[model samples]
Target: MTTHPAETVHDALREEPCEDAWWMPGPDGFAACALSSSARTVAEARRFTRATLEGWRLCSSVAEDAALVVSELVSNALRYGAGGGGKEPAAVCPAWLALTRQDGTVLCAVSDAGTTAPVVKVPDHLAESGRGLHIVDQLSDAWGWTPPDRSGKTVWATVSSVRV
Candidate 1:
């Protein structure tokens, strides 16, 4: 998902998605799935991400990075998204994870039924949490969220690597 010089990351994030067909592994190069606010969601997403990247023969290092991004994105979706009220989400909150590769870049995007904008936090050294976005920012070529539409929002990150 190379961006033009004049177009910003936000612009890319806002691009219209074919909601029904986005996950199809057709000519556009993608894999996607539905997610819930379950505690196991992050782990499941990680495994899915790794398998998809491996199937596509992405560089191992890049696959690792993309997996991390997937972890953080899904973790955030489970923890704070879908109006979790700052605690474990008790109700089913729908979410989705999509991976796409083109040229040398692999893009990871997760959509959740939450409207909050993500923030990179300055966690205390001994803190047990709150570093998700920081890790995503460090690993990704670029990262940001799409403005929430009627349903919710999508947060995306990109990592570029050579094909294996």
Candidate 2:
């Protein structure tokens, strides 16, 4: 985790990531963390996303939605991605959570070794699963997944800086 100077929540939310108000090739407004496929992953991803957004001066504006979306994405990855069936070794199931700010949008992406594409399922009210993508769809401006390559596939969602 990167530590930045403390600023007022309002000021931070209104501020952009870089000095010239543009994203460079580096960590101008990007943060990422590895996640384990355990019960604590959802909470860890939420904390990491919220903190990174706060450091980027976007917490007050989109933190709630971003955190929720991050949890959903990470949960799906843990449950369905490679090594998710509780049999594979952790080394074979590497996963990561990434955050980036670009052109007034915050992008949250989760990458995992699993090759299965994510799908949105319609479940009954009492069903315990299959609603992750639904919540992500409702909260994000846009969401999609990339096909798995040698490294793995990534599922991403975008949230506008300005609230809807």
- The 10-residue segment with the lowest total lDDT in model 1: 17-26
lDDT per residue (tens digit) for residues 65-138 in model 2: 99999999988887778463344543543577888997568999988877778988986679888888999998
| Model 2 ranges off by over 4 Å | 1-27, 59-61, 84-93
What is every candidate's alpha-carbon RMSD to the true fold? 11.1, 8.3
TM-scores, in order shown?
0.75, 0.75
- How do the residues 1-164 of candidate 1 rate in per-residue lDDT, one tens digit apiece? 22234543223332442222112332357887666555656766786677778778878898899999999998887666656343343244367788989966899998777767787888777999988899998899999999875567889999988433
Among all windows of ten consecutive residues in candidate 2, which has the lowest summed lDDT?
17-26
